[model samples]
Target: MKERIVVKIGSNVLTRKDGTLDVTRMSALVDQVAELHKEGIEVILVSSGAVASGKTELKIKDKLDTISARQLYSAVGQAKLINRYYDLFHQHRIVCGQVLATKEDFATRRHYLNQRNCMTVMLDNNVIPIVNENDTISVNELMFTDNDELSGLVAAMMGSHKLIILSNIDGIFDGDPNKSQSKVIREIDTQKDQIEEFIQSSKSTAGRGGMQTKYNIARKVAEEGIEVIIANGRKDNILIHLLKDKETLCTRFIPSTKGVSSVKKWIAHSEGFTKGEIHINEGAKDALLGEKAISLLPVGVTKVTGNFETDDIVRIIDESGKQIGIGRTSYNSQKANEIIGKNNKKAIIHYDYLYIEK
Candidate 1:
């Protein structure tokens, strides 16, 4: 099988400092991806710049509120962005397809499978799938945290070998970026490092995500056994350089040794789509994380937080409210509540449908 990778280009990388679309930069990225394609590596791109592009075209001098302006700008910008990609890819005789996804699309098994199949078909035909959020329609619950989160889900969904996140900065720094003598961390071992303390909470002017967001998504994808690289997008031939291991200053996240199943990957990345949460006791937590694979029984559930139907994705939290895992329930919340503390041999969540977080 050919190696597959998902490359995410942030808004900061796609646009100029003045918040305008940088056609030259976009062209360069396309060229790098085209070269990778010729080398037999399947590449999927998740790009963010619609709002920035739309703002430049619309030139809205006065602020028209956050949500309304975002809707207007994204609706107009998405077309321009996709058209630009079409033109750029066409120059190299490479066919590319645009995919605009919403959070609700991954809420159900059917919708999730449908989207996955579409991308699979495109890949099977040697077509590059260019993905972006359906920003015009997404709001509140229907929206993703940012494109970083979306790209992580896409990488997990497609079972990609690696996920490369491109931003303006080099990578995660040991200290503040503004501070002198702060150095970029070349590698991150999620299991050992307390990376959160080093990340800044500030968002970029051209993008919704910050350093913290990238770190989080990188860790999540790496836990699923997908290698992740966070690098500076502004550098020339950054994509090609990283792939060739050409001495680049970037943070490489080492993938876990144990590989997760496709269904479990879906459950792990679908926390946003959870209908409810199940609070499990300490014993249940230990059992699920034990050496032997175990199913979640109703007796282990101490409290049910919200209403959800059977087969709905739910968060599995410990008694202290820390989320330990996620799973699809075989019984509804009401039924599970009724059977709590009772001897029910049937598994509320089978091992196959459960994902334990590391």
Candidate 2:
């Protein structure tokens, strides 16, 4: 099998300082991807720049409400973005497809499988698929955290060997980017590294995601046995450089030693899409995290929060109000409330549908 990889380009990398789409940068990136395609490496691109592109094109001086502004900008910008991609890819005699996805697409097994199949067909036909969140319609709960999160899910779904995230900054820093001495961390072992201290909570001017979001998604995907690289997109021939040289100045996350099942990866990545939460006692938490594969019983549940139906994805919280994991519930909120701490126990979440977090 050929080496498959997913490449995510941030809005900061695709837009100029004036907030307009950077045609030169886009062409350069596309050229690199075209070269990789010629080398027989399957590439799926997850791009973020629609809102910025739309805002620049509309030139609206007055401020609009959040939802309306996003809708207007994304609605206008997505067309321009895809059209540019089409023209650029066509120049290299390569066909590219646009796939706009929402958070709801990964909510269930059927929907996830459908999306997986679509991407599979596109790749099998030697066509590159450009994926982006449906920002025009997504609002509040329906929205993905950012394209970083969306790309992670897409990479996992496609069973890609690697995920390459392109950002404006040169990977992750040890301290702060503003500081001159804060050196870039070149390698990250997800199983051993404590990276929380180095990550700062800051959003980009042109995009919703920050360095923290990238770190999180990178760590999550790495845990599922996928290599993740965070590098500077503005650097000349960045993708090509990474492929040709292993000594590139980029943050590389090593995959976990233990492999995760496809179903478990889906469940683990669906934390943002959970509908409700279940609070369990220490004993239940221990059993789930321990050697024996055990189902969540009604007797172990102390409290249930949020109204959710059967088969809805929910977070499993410990008694201390910390999230331990997530799973598909076999019982609804009402039924779960009735059966808490009783001798007549029923499986609230079956072992097959449960995934314990590390």
Top candidate (TM-score):
1
Candidate 2, residue 238: Cα displacement in angstroms equals 0.9
State every prediction's TM-score relative to the real structure.
0.97, 0.96
Candidate 1 C-alpha lDDT tens digits along 1-358: 9999999999999998888999899999999999999999999999999998898888667879888999999999999999999999999999999999999888787888999999999999999999999999998888898999999999999999999999999999999987889999999888888778899899988888898889999998998899999999999999999999747889999999887898888888888988898888999999988988899998898988789999999999998889988999998988888888777469889999998886
lDDT of candidate model 1 versus the reference: 0.91
What lDDT score is found at residue 316 in candidate 2?
Answer: 97
Q: What lDDT is reached at residue 178 by model 1?
A: 78
Which residue segments of model 1 deviate by more than 4 Å?
61-63
The Cα error of candidate 1 at residue 291, in Å, is: 2.5
lDDT of 2 at 166: 98
